[model samples]
Target: MAEFLLEALSEEIPARMQKRAAEEFSQIFTSELEKVGLAHEPANCFVTPRRIALNIDGLPLQQSTVVEERRGPRVDAPAAALDGFMRSNNISRDQIEERETKKGRFYFVKIETKGKLTKDVLPAIIETSLKKFAWPKSMRWGSNSFRWVRPLHSILAVFEAEVLHGELDLGHDKLVFTNMTRGHRCCGAEKISVDNFAGYQDQLRKARVIIDRNERKRLIQEEAKKLADAKKLRLREDEALLEEVAGLVEWPNILMGSIDEEFMEVPSEALISAMRSHQKYFSLETLDGSLAPYFITVSNMPSDSTRDATIVVGNAKVLRARLSDARFFWDQDLKSKLDERVLALSKINFFDKLGSLGDKSERLQKLVPTICEFIGLDNVNGAVKAARLAKADLSTMMVSEFPELQGVMGGYYASADGELPEVCRAISGHYAPLGPTDACPSEPLTITISIADKIDTLVGFFAINEKPTGSKDPFALRRAALGIIRTILENKLRIPLKQLISKSLDEYPHLTDSNELLDFINERLKVYLRASGVQPDLIAANFEAGKEDDLYRLIMRVKALEELLASDDGANL
Candidate 1:
């Protein structure tokens, strides 16, 4: 048994591309090894901005020995046919043996070949691996026209203790590999030799670089949590932001910084979005759930700057400028009439085949009353008014500048428009339960508007044959579907999903083939049910056996069916 370590060091790979590159590299290598009869256990791949590394253990040092069998022409065939068979198998007539078959007699050649050493086979594998490497976007650099995600800086192709030297010299100007790598770009700045994977990781760690992303994320979380606790504040839990930042740096140093008093006056959401989207800083919130005055920033460099003042002042200045622009947009948006802007949405195209935002808004205005009655909303007019204004924010300059603030700005704009308090609240609440565990709007008016808004999106997209394709949901239809599913189930709404989807589609006569869309919606429901630990067969059985308009009733049936399966004498047969 032997181990292999392959590393491709390049300029910073995009965070999104790193994971796939690592995964595909290992898979391709393992498959190539297996093709040559080399058996292996699981291999691991790790990725960072500057490099991708793979290590495989329990791999055979040589291909397993095997017998090769070749079938030839029949025993009584013509001389030419026998000669052709002998040529194909590279054997003489004397080497061939006759074998009896049901149809006729055939000649056979058997040969045993010695296992090839891993050392001799790996260079060809490495060369092929480089050629077959898939990059989301690659570029040609230097005299050679070979394209790569970035300029291929170095290729540390080693097998066990040997360097596996080859003709293709891989490196940048004056940067050559002699079985060596550099440590922390900041700390050592000098190249060091490594004989194995353990030496590489240890040396890199000593130089201030952490190879594992999970380790960096853990350090950031722990240090940020400590800083938040010390400040008597809470870090806004943004796992997506945390993961992105974790991948962006080789070394992470978490630092606490305070926002200016004026900037803190900006709405917490806008402030947080500004900090997160631009600066990659995590916002802290006060115990009362208001945006705290402080934020946490992670640096790739060690906290060794004089008094750590360089990082602090630089980040604070950047954050202030970002927050200033946010405040400007907020004030500018508030001064305009939100209701007047709702009329302007008529110009903004929702889709060419479909109508504009205004048309969609009008549809919601009509649909909301019906949905409100179905949901038993106490204030029918309020729900309809909120639905009409909710999408109006899409036309506002503030939302245009900060797309994350669409629903948020709607709530504020509705309030400024002197609408009912409940209506204004519903503007924000209409997009509730964006994810499975995200909060669902329980308020009657908000629930009505929420359902009307989401159902419209689902029907509109599915009607256009733009349904999501296996994790490639560019239009976010999956999220919208999940939101609708969560809203209906959590609110315990008795309204039929299919009926609402059908009713919404009926309004858009241009959108034909709606029955297909309805079927897709039902499929999406099964996904949600399976995720909630419901038996997939039970969901399929219920969908096949029952015809219910209410989503909650369908889900309750699936849940009851699952419970029945869990009992002592439950019959699956």
Candidate 2:
């Protein structure tokens, strides 16, 4: 038994690409080994910004020999046929054995294939795997036709105590395989030799590089928490930001930086967005859960006193510039009422043929009242007001700069414009339940407007024949449909989707029957129900009972039926 270690060190691969690349490297390597009948224990892959490494253990020194039986021409066949059979099997007439069959006697040959040493077969497999490795985006570098995510610097291929010696033809240049790798580029670019996986990891760590991404993530998280706690603040949890920052560094040095007090007046969301998106910094919140005037930045360098101060000051300066820009957008956007920006939406295209956002907003304003009437909600005025102003912020300078703040900015501007509080809340909540785990709107006005917004978009797109097909949902119609399903189901809304779709389609004179839209909604409902752990048959049985359009009622019936089926008599039926 032996161990194998392979590392491909390169220039910084994009943080988003590292994990995927490592998986590809491991999969390709193991698959190639499998094709050659080389069995091994479970393989592991590790990725950092600069490298993808793989470690395999308990691999046989050589593949097991295989025996194959080859049948040839019958004994009574012509000499040429017999000759051809012997030639094809690479066997002479003397090597062919006579076999008795029901029809007649035939000639058969036994062939034994000798297995090669693991070290002998691994070089070609590694090279072929490297050449065929897939990357989302790759580039050819330095006159080489071979492409990689970045310039390939070295190949470290070791099996047990010996290096797998070979030359990889990377088109313009050849990479000679060796058991040598370099550690953290900033620490020292000196060659580090290793005998096995453990040695490789230990040397890399000593050289200021943490080869395991999960470990790097843990270090960043723990250190950031400690730094925040020391200042009586808490770190705002951002798993996505943590994952990305982990990939951006080999050695993470967590440092706390101060935000300018003037910038704190900007909405915490805006400030946080500016810091996280632009500078990749994590915002800190005070003990009372308000935005603290502090942020945490993870540096790729060591945390020496001088270096820490320099990195912190530099990041703080960068964050200040971003927050200043955010503050400017915030102030400039408040200069006009949200309703005043409504007319400007005429210039912003909603889709290719669906007219401008102004057109959609108009439809929503009309459709929301119908939805409110159907649901027997008396807040028709508030729903209509919110629907009208929901997308008006799309024209605001703040939303233009931070497109993610569209509905959120509307809420702020609506409140500033002295709109009803319910209307403002609805305007902000219209885009809620963005995903399965996101919160659904509980306020009556907010729920009405939210459903109205999603329904209008779904019907408008389906009418234009732009509905999501398979995996090609360019317009995210599936997500829109799912959002509608989740909101209705979670809120236990009693509105019939069929009637609501009909009313929404009526707003668009060119659009006709809501059958297709109803089917799409039903499909999304089944998906939502299944995800919520409801049995498919139960959902089908409930739908089969009719009144499928009333989701809340259908769910109740499904639950009741599920309980009935759990009983002994009902189960027997």
Candidate 3:
């Protein structure tokens, strides 16, 4: 048995596409190997921005030799036919045997085919795998009809530490295989030669390239934290961004840069969003948990004081430009009270089928009072007031630029406008628990507004028959349902889905989809409950009892059934 290594070097693949491409390409190759009876050891795949390397160990030198019988014409067949069969099998009449068959006597020959060497078979395997490989988005490079995520440059194929002979036929060009591979685009050597996987990795590292993305991520995190620690600050942890940044560089050099004090005055979220989204820079925080006036960026080159200073300065200049736009939106937005932006909501459509956001805002104002029934019975005029401005920030310039900060900026702007703290918190948190792990809002007023907003959205969309289909919730209606379920259950609020949904459907005249919307929410509840360790059968049993709209009570009944089922007396029944 020997090892095999194949590396395909290409132009920079988009950071988001790099890992998946490597994984899918690895799967294709592994499948091809199995199809050819090359049952090898597990394969390890490595990816960077510019290359994908695969290593397979303990593969056989060649396939196993096999013996089989081939049938020939009947004994009475013509001499020409018998001669043709003998020639095809490379045998003589003495080598042939006469066999009695149901039809008649026939001629047969025993054939032994030699196993092909693994090296000889691998080129065809590699070519077949490459042709079968797919990308999320691919492009044709130059005039070549064959496509890759980027340009297909060079291929490195080595088996048993020997360069394998192979080539991929591009429609307009051909890529001959070689043992040669290039390193980092700018800082590394132009060309490097290797024999085995270990030497390939070592040579690439010496040439200023890191073949493994996880190692690059680790180096980036450790070095970045050290840099922040030196300045009495710490790096903000974002695993997603770390993965992305790791994909953006072959060699990560962590460096810290200053943030202009004037730009720091902008909301940290806005500044952080600008840095992360536009430049992929990670933010730092001070010892007291305040936003630090510095950012960490990963460079693809070595960290030399003279040259590194130039890179940091260049990165800071770009960041300064991005933050300036964020700052301008902040400064300009605060000039008018957040309430003044409510009219602008009319100009922004919530959905093409659903009315404008202004119309939805009006619906929310009417919906919150009904929602206050389950959360709080007494006067809810204050929550209704908060609900009126829940979506006001959707029209703000800052939100237009950074749409992810819609509710967050609204909360900030509302505080600046001297709005009640209750209203600010309510508006800001109305979109909480966006996903399964997101924090669910517990404050009564905030919960009230959130439930109302989500319910209104669910009703309007369902009223128009725009419910989410399998694996495709274009409007994220499932998330909205999950949000509502999380809020009701987490807050221990007793909400009757049938009644609340019926009342919400009334807000949209001539629409009678209350049962449909309630069923959707109930399905989401089942999903949420199953994730929390509840039995699906018990939940369904409780639902089958009919009109079990109060989620809290329904859950209590299901748990009671589960406990009973666990008991001997109930088990007997």
Best model per lDDT: 3
Candidate 3: list runs displaced more than 4 Å.
66-114, 377-379, 544-547, 567-573
- Which regions of candidate 1 deviate over 4 angstroms? 92-94, 167-178, 305-307, 416-418, 462-465, 468-472, 497-499, 509-515, 559-573
Tens-place lDDT digits, model 3, residues 521-554? 8888888888999877887898889766788888
Which rank order by lDDT, best down to worst? 3, 2, 1
* Candidate 3 minimal-lDDT segment of 10 residues: 509-518
Candidate 1 structure quality by residue, lDDT tens digits, 528-552: 8787777667888899975656778
Backbone clash pairs for candidate 3 read none
Estimate TM-scores for all models.
0.92, 0.97, 0.91
lDDT of each: 0.80, 0.88, 0.89
Kindly list the per-residue Cα lDDT of model 2 for residues 226-264, writing each as its tens digit.
Answer: 999899899999998998999999989999999989988
Winning model by TM-score: 2
Q: Given candidate 1, what's the lDDT at residue 496?
A: 63
**Model 2, runs deviating above 4 Å:** 100-105, 513-515, 544-547
